[model samples]
Target: MDTAPARDSAPPRTTAADARRGAPASRRPVLPYLLIAPTVLALAVVLGYPLAGLLLLSFQDMTRRELFSGAAPPWAGADNYRTVLTDGFFWEVLARTLLFTLVCVGVTMALAVPVALLMRRVDPWLRAVMAGVLVAVWAMPVMVAASVFRWLSDADDGVLNWLLGLLPGVDLDKHNWFYDPWQGFAVIAGVVVWGALPFAVLTLEAALTQVPRELAEAAVLDGANARQLFRHVTLPVIRPALVLVTALLAIGCTGVFNEIWLLRGGRPESDYYLLGVYSFIESFAVNRYSTGAAISVITVLLLLGGAVVYVRRLRALGEIE
Candidate 1:
């Protein structure tokens, strides 16, 4: 009898999915993380170091002497923080900053929503023209825009005064816009809103374009009026974008510096002191680097707290994972 040799059983072949399932749950793909490592490292070096330095500086008593002489400053622990928190003026500035930011964000959103909706309804050519104009305005340098606005509101020979002089009995010739803090802030707010509109309008319009046409048409067919359709459908679709724009505007307005500094001729009065301007005045004008750093830290903490609150709210609403 011929007996065939026993054939050795071949090992079972494993597919990628099978191997993945067999792998430890903690094991993740390394290539994606490796690819992003350089960027993360660069940002840490660029941003993290400065932030760390600021924190350290806030704890010390750094003066102009230490700055120019390259000598280590004396440690002051929490003195800077104590000084700022105890000052009534600091509270006023903080309150002013918050109120101003709220107003700017409110006005920007109010104007942006309508403009974006109008762009959606307008002819394509008109939309393109409007977009181009907005882009041009957005591209304008802040300094140049501020200078032009200054000239327009100049005490002598201003186009705005000239135009206002034409009104029935409103003589605004030789008007000093910066003399009154309220009027000065209004002008600054106008400039801020004008510069901000392009980005807000464009972002909202882009979000609007992502809205499902079928859903809108279905809502219209279901007897939903224009207001109802927007409230029920359009608003939900663009809510995320609106929130993002509003947050950014609030942060920007809170840190407003360039416009106020330029408009006030680089010497903002007590009435015009926002947080950023106050910090600048403390650091450079008064040579209190430690106090400035402390203020900067406080501003950062406030912003971070706001961000955390917004994130939690969104998560609670099931808007984010």
Candidate 2:
């Protein structure tokens, strides 16, 4: 007992050394912000500066002369916004935009989900080939897609008409696809959906692959069929991906200018005019710089709202998990 007390009286050398060793490790200087600096700087230059300038211009009644001649433009208050709201044609254009976005998004998601599911079940080699095709579609230049489709939809010697001619009892000469508003809209929506589907498929397919195999196996063992498994298990697991892809698709669809511009044969007065087309026409054609700026600001706000809703949904889904 006496010896034990003597040993306890000795200084705890190893403990002191251990505490000394841990002090440096625990007080390690953190510089995580350095890694994210480049991303923050890029966003500031690319998105932030332009966005700020656009918002400021939206409130000014700036003509082309005022913009280019360095003269200060008078304030417009809500005048530009009022013009957009009060004009019957503006309301009509807005309605068309909403309808087109909803229809195209609905169709794209409807087609893409089933296709993604099928691709998941396919052999790896075949899946790779399918992904390659989608990548090719995605990699096509937006302008190039529009140009090719324009050539196909031409009234003379167009491939679409050429193919229609081969169908039994098909009337080839009745419709000018780009002439009527509804016809033009159909073509536009179709082209937009095709362009957007590749991204949707790619995103959802990756999500499908992330689904745990054991969950699927358990479902199968419990007499769950393919449809049941997807409905109950797979969908819940991939809901976040679906939300993200939907947001991306919506953002892309909301700013559909190039395809509509080309499909309208670059007509300024085409009924397919949305905010995107309106902004371009205002800036370059009509020289309504303030109006163009306002439209751009609105489009950006709409996209941001959609993105926020998407992220919130994703967060809520994650919490339930």
Candidate 3:
């Protein structure tokens, strides 16, 4: 009886290509690729090309003579790295760079967190005012910030010194901040922290405002104190933002040249020569493009390594959510 009548065959299944053809034009993959093409091209030209050239140069003794004369020399192998590593100044610069980055990141977060919390409670008008100030600070060109900080930190005819004189119990000297390495580090760190605060505040403020009211109410109902609620709930929710802020700060710190160069321009003998400064000196002062490239490559590698490690740690902690 079952074989008496043949069942009608089901409609043919759709292949991916057939399905794509039937899909809406806006949902096509080609449109997305076209939209992203310009950005990808720009990134390759600006970032990728330079990085490739720099890596190639790092492997050879690429002097100005050889470059102009078109006479390639033998490869130096890892000599450039060896020279950079064995130098005492390199170690000092590395230490200063790390210390500056760490301290500035900590100070920036410390300043940002309270401001973000306060922003959550403020009236709309005050919030707008705060946002305006932060935007203004963020919009200040990096070079302008460096110049303003330099003028303010000047030993003579400087506003900071003038302000110090106003204090009743303090007697101060016209200390040459740019001359002393420690003082220069402090000044640079302070400027970086100040410049970075706006971004950190904005980011953290947005994150803090997004903390669910239901969660806060539940915490309160569970007899959680203000400190406990903030420590357990608020901090965990904002951990992603904190990591992002630290990564940005670290990247910026590694490439700090303008401030140190402008402030300590004539002092290579001083202990404030950072890797960026070193790279600049090699390229311009010594006309050693290869050496400069090597330094840049090393800096980039270090930064990328740090980022990779941070991402791995984030994955390990499952904090991305």
Task: Pick the lDDT winner.
Answer: 1
The stretch of ten residues in a row with the least summed lDDT in candidate 1 is 16-25
Model 3: residues with Cα > 4 Å off, grouped in runs: 1-41, 70-73, 265-269, 317-321
List clashing residue pairs in candidate 1.
Answer: none
For every model shown, the clashing-pair count is: 0, 0, 0
Better of 2 and 3 by lDDT: 2
What TM-score, over all chains together, does every model reach? 0.88, 0.85, 0.83
Query: Global CA lDDT of candidate 1, please?
Result: 0.90
Model number with the top TM-score: 1
Error of 2 at 246 (Å): 0.4
Q: Against the unseen true structure, what C-alpha lDDT does each candidate score?
A: 0.90, 0.83, 0.82
**Tens digits of per-residue lDDT for model 1, 1-321:** 999999999998878557646656577588879999999999999989999999999999998788989999999999999999999999999999998888888999999999999999999999999999999999998888888888888889778889989999998977998899888898888788888999999999999998899999999999999999999999988988887888788888889999999988898999999999999999889999999999999998988887887787676655765
Where is model 3 poorest over a 10-residue stretch in terms of lDDT? 261-270
Candidate 3 lDDT over 1-321, as tens digits, reads 456677799999978557645767776579769999999999999999989978888878887788789997569888887877787877787787777778888888889999999998999999999999999999988778878888888887778878887899765558677677777788888778778899999999988877888999999999999999999889888887788878887888878877777666555544777788888888778887777777888889989998997897686556642
Residue pair clashes in candidate 2: none
